[model samples]
Target chain A: MIQKGMSVIVKTVTKITLGFILLYAVYISLNGHTGPGGGFAGGVIVALSFVHIMLVFGKEMALKRLRSYVLRGLTCAGALIFLYAATVKFSGGCVPFGAFLEKSVSCRLFNSEITLPFCEMLIIGAGLFAIFVALVLLSKSDRYDSE
Target chain B: MIEIHLILLFMIAAAIVAVEARDLLSSVVAIGSVGIGLSLAFLILKAPDLAIMQLVVEIMSLVILVRATMRQDLPFSMSGRWVFNTFSTVLFMCVFLGAAYIALKNIPLGGGDFGIASGVYLREAIPATGAKNVVAAITSNYRLMDTLGEVAAIFTAVVGVMAIARRVGRPR
Candidate 1:
């Protein structure tokens, strides 16, 4: 497996910044309906963080941490979850295909009605990120004529 | 207006430099500068969402370009035919801009009609959706079909990238 990654400075910076980047992506997605960003922008950021890790720490490290199959699974699962969120009927009985979900059910911790759409964003972003990683890194086993 | 025009001029210069630079890395960085300028313009135009998206997308594209250039020794020299191609490009841009000007000359530019529409949206958006962010309110509530279509398009593009990458993965 390829072991070499970028220089130490990059790795250090990446280590420091990756978590914050991911958090910001979540913030963007969660604030989609209430703020500037929504699912697409947040998902791109989420994918970008993983891609950054892969770029800085090598594909092996990235793959070990987040396997190709796991990523593919996430993509499917996330899409399905997103679809569920889209099709699921609210209390008012309107299926929000355009991400018009509002949460009426009040929980103690999370009272935000925008939870479903946020959840959808999280899954989709993570899934898309994995997909991007798989695309660029190209696992050795994925090759048809393996050397 | 003057500030925006200045920013646009800077963007044009940056774009030219990006195209003219021979070093692959520097060219990519110059392109990034153009991206920054574009995002700045977007911010000036009061489109924070577009600005944010532009920056992220720019970085991603730069990363991909860096990777591709690293693997292959890309040719930098434009062939002798570049002059004609450049001329054609300039002609197209001029024609396009002229057409746009003619088309938009009659249509209202930030006038009474536009203000009224925005005023109505501002009045109705919050109470209807309980969203404080007007941009979010419009995207998620008002233009949800458009968002859905956009998501579908992105999904399709990702799927296509996967397929092409798969083909590239196989050894020749």
Candidate 2:
């Protein structure tokens, strides 16, 4: 019975709100340089958006949106992105993980430091989503075996 | 100042409700409110970054916790030693309150000095990182190594969870 998902009203609401949530997450992450929000916070919101779908529409439906392999790949890609920022040495930089990109005007969307938060946002969002999916699948299988 | 105190009072009330509620779902919801209250408190304290992170983390935690409780028939059982438990709880609360009082006694309630580091960050963050948000500049640029380690830690944790879940739940 739980496999079928929630009521129609809830599903409908989720359908309408999911896109907005994802967009908000992206905005928050990108605007980290300009405001209070950052990659970690944005990534958490992204994970919650997916979790919202899972709660209303069941694990299978959520997994269909973001497949397990894709989630894994995303997590890896996020880590690699951060590593690339850390390792790549631009000429004339003293520090290893120093700002390689040129700094433009303050409070703008594009900046040198944006890459770090962007990578963090991807890593956190995809990693957490993967963990949630694994745990949900595990619980399902446990219940299945017992039944 | 008064508003912050009121919000804190609300948080305390919500925490007590979370602990004492009989219904599992009610307890979860109560705790969730406590998290929201904390986020609000952060915003009031002028730390919007912390508030945003707190709010999103609270929502994600609520979702995961509610999912764990759903379809589970296990009741929240208490230890048989109710008297001891009560005594311990009261004692711990007293200790915590005492520590909190001692900790906060030296610090002013609101709008005090941000110290040398904060002053430097506030002054130079924009010039150095060209980011308007001091917190973002500090985390993403100044503390790049720290953020890298954090991301690495999370990646490792997710891999561990996947491994454990697969091992335990896989059908033979």
Candidate 3:
């Protein structure tokens, strides 16, 4: 209907804001242990940033930047990391879901407890991005076939 | 408490406007405002985590909704009036700034004390998980298996979307 993307103003604004959105997402992810946000919240913001890119630059441009396969792989990798962390202790006779590593002092970056949120951040962000790309591409194909 | 009530009331009013508005685009924007109000309410309630999530989720959904509805209203004549549009946009901006001013001016401090169950979690969280954020401790340590399950669920959903969307549906 309208074009591949919006007007010039939207594009310029998006370019300026994209980096801040991404920076905020990472901040939220890293600070999950120290403050208010967690992995899921961070992941959602990450996905939204990608959505913003797609909306302003067109789907083809977005796909060019990050292909669908990469997103899928990232999602799977996040899940695997979480699974390994959860089950790795079973081989040593420790409880399956217990802490995977020694819990360090609070507010530290290397705390083992951050793994779950980190993995969650990866899985939700990449998975949601993949889903959105799929749906958008699907609708495009639908329009072409019907025409 | 009063601040929370006022934000809630504002949210309710915006929701009513969203439902009753004649223009689909304005309605969608109104609904977005309601979400912003709800996020502000969360902030007042001292749940910064929820507030951040709500604000981002609201933004993402609003973008998607606007994209979906924009095509349907392209031919509408009411949107063509530049003067009225300018006036409405200015008014909206003024109202938004006013609300933001009030919200910023009245933001309360941290939520009072932990409740009974929360009291125990607050005490035990650091010792158990060595994490300062109690919510993060519960999610990533105390209830980690659930987080695993959630990840699995998200993975399954993405796979399903990929599987279903790959089909071209064109007549062969």
On TM-score, the leading prediction is 2
Clashing residue pairs, candidate 2? none
Query: Mind giving the per-residue lDDT tens digits that candidate 3 earns over A28-82?
Result: 9879888998888889889989988888888778889998778988898888877
Give the whole-model CA lDDT for all candidates, comma-separated.
0.68, 0.79, 0.76
Residue-wise C-alpha lDDT for candidate 1, range A1-147, written one tens digit per residue: 234588999999999999999889888877766667766677778778888887788766877898766766665665555445444432233444334534442221122335445644655566566556645545433232233
What's every prediction's RMSD, in angstroms?
Answer: 5.1, 4.5, 10.2
| TM-score between model 2 and native | 0.81
- Which candidate has the highest DockQ of all? 2
Residue A53's lDDT within candidate 3 is 88
If ranked by DockQ, best first, what sequence of candidates would result? 2, 3, 1
Q: Which residue window of length 10 is worst by lDDT in model 2 chain B?
A: B68-77
Give the lowest summed-lDDT range of ten residues in model 2 chain A. Answer: A102-111
Q: For candidate 3, list the clashing residue pairs, or say none.
A: none
Which candidate leads the pack in lDDT?
2
Q: What is the per-residue lDDT of model 2 for residues A1-147, given as tens digits with 9 covering 90 to 100? A: 465678999999989988999999989998988888988998998888888888788867788889888988988988886776664422223334345544322213223456767888888898888787776666654357435
Per-residue lDDT for B83-164 in model 2, tens only?
Answer: 9989999999999999999988977544467476677888898898778988878877777678778888888998998788
